[model samples]
Target: MARTTKPLTNTEVKQAKPKDKVYTLSDGGGLQLRVKPNGSKFWLFDYHRPYTKQRTCLSFGSFPDISLADARHNRDTSRELLAKNIDPKEYRDEENRINEAAHSNTLEHIAEKWLEVKKANVSADHATDTWRSLELHIFPSLGKVPIHKITAIKTIDIINPIAAKGNLETVKRLCQRLNEIMVYAVNTGLIASNPLAGIGKANQNPIKKHLPTLKPEQLPALLKTLAFASIKTTTRCVIEWQLHTMVRPSEAAGAQWNEIDFENNVWDIPAERMKSKKPHKVPLSDQALNLLELMKPISSHSKYIFPSNSDIKKHTNSSTANMALKRMGFENKLVAHGLRSIASTTLNEEGFDPDVIEAALAHTGKNEVRNAYNRALYLERRKPMMQWWSDHIEKAATGNMSLAGQKGLKVVSQ
Candidate 1:
């Protein structure tokens, strides 16, 4: 039943017919080619590895391009590698790893690396909002697709639905963000042009400007619970301080212990930390002072005045305090940010210098000449205004408003 052959012959290969016979021809010392009827031939080599007793079959290339003679030569080379106690599978995997690593140095990979680098410069809230616009709404549809594949039509498809949902602002913001990301991508040679460029003529709906600033009557109930009692301690203090200082919640939320000068009752916000990217000094009101004094026992040992109650290393998540407002039944009723409207309105009506109030809130370039001359101009005057506001707010929190103060208020009838 066993006929021994020393070497495979081309005549044997040519005479083969589909499924008729599978010829096992010994090419050399160990290599064999199983010639099939379908004209398909495969090389199989069996030999004992140097360190292992188990004999394994090593597959070389198929016939023609790999003749039986060459298979024998390759089999010898493989045995040489095996004699060095090296695994062919492991060696193949390592070679693949090197190739993959070389390929990962492409433009697309570098763009992602750039995004991670830029993330450190942006606030956590803005970073979340930006990445959401990029990843969910943008990426799945275009992620694995090369960066260059993003054309105007494709970008339009991605943004049009967002515009149609009456969220024109979000779409616009997303477009702007994509432009920025792609421009960075372009500069890094990831792509040539920003596909988002000049695509604005698309039928994008307009952004809705509906901030949740409350009516005068609603401010008291909002502040009352926020000042002393209802929400969690960290939440309450954050909202109260937010109400006290008209700065954006990000500026307040990211506040470090070193930024405040409690002894002087003056808080000088450094330029880099300011929304305007200019130094600002907020005069601390008695109420703002009291709020800080109360928070000291909780976080005096830490760097952030209000260290995230959740962890020792990380600051609070940007949404924690805002979400607290929604939980307290102030969803769309009173936004944590609407406190800016309260300050802008209250300060303007009080007959305190308009410029001073503007500077206190760190509004930039409203008075170009004044802005140019004075960066920290309000530090001294901001102190009294801040304290006066603390006094005025204490009255509001207790439901006692000066009638003179009431006249300037625009009351929305409930």
Candidate 2:
């Protein structure tokens, strides 16, 4: 037995009462509106497909947004699909799934999810840096777009504005961060493409000022000025360690006493925290050994090798190193990053292999083979290399050019 609903006037339908009464409203086609007792209206098509005998209910949108006429139009269109052997409800479900997936897999949403997933893996200090760059520089601009929609033009729009203001370093870092997130998204099936893959270094503002390292000759003067910068003890320790071992400043700041082998004279940085995602074994130089010895008594109980009593949580900020340069009047001339430059420059002058220097700095490459091959830290080999380097800096900081020959020179016992 089928139930039939009476036709209703426009005014009656507009002020429809809630009951078991079902009002049938014409939708200008074979589709009709069925109003339930709850006053919720739904549109259903009554027309059979042109060639098919099966009657299907093609759902149109809800009452308010979709007018009765449009509902009828959509129902007719669905009927056409039915004629072509397609189940409209099933097709609509597939389309809805795709739309929902797109909304979820949008670039900004996925990047944020990636951040949340890695929150514990990265340090408070490192996590904050990555977040700040994305929130302030990258996300505000491109946060809503789907990751695959990220094109070169969009990248330029996001990056060039910052680059024009001489924030080339920031731009470069933002690009790297974007690449990291997008690559993560691609691997996880969120996106089919990476915006950062294959774009050469030159494409990212190649003409910008490249950070330079202190030459072997300049090391003496630079060290002298850096040590005497008259700032916090933490800055001095940071700069000294930067020169002593040539490890990245962030790695040095995050170093723990347990990671440093005082007896063996090595700082084994875990692969997770290292920039290259490979373990780095930093051989403690004579000076590095001395520095640790001095620091042992200061913040001995704290986990951080270079701890700040100012706060129990954070070790130290990157600004500490830069401010030290500013105090020594090398503000723009020398930055915390320049310490890496100085190390790279001096290592080359001292005749160490380029690959060794690259490994020491934890630089990863595009070639997976080369990257895996160069991950070896060469600790015993790097020991004398670091020791010679530390001694070389000490001589220069003391203003003696004759100290250059003294490098790698062993003292013979009488």
Using lDDT as the measure, the top candidate is 2
lDDT, candidate 1, equals: 0.69
lDDT of each: 0.69, 0.70
lDDT of 2: 0.70
Clash pairs, candidate 1, are 17-37, 18-37, 271-278, 271-279, 283-382, 283-383, 285-387
TM-score, candidate number 1 = 0.66
* Candidate 1 structure quality by residue, lDDT tens digits, 1-414: 966656657786555555687766666667887777777888888776556657777778787778756777777777677778876645666978866654554434544676686665654466666676677787767655556666779878877887777777777777776677678778876566787787666865574666787765566776555543455666667766777887778878777778888677667777666656566777766667666767778787887776787784555555666788888777876677788888778778778888788777777786767885664565676777877776666666554322112232222222
**Model 1, backbone clash pairs (residues 3+ apart or across chains), number:** 7
Could you estimate the TM-score for every candidate?
A: 0.66, 0.72
In candidate 1 the C-alpha lDDT for residue 313 amounts to 56
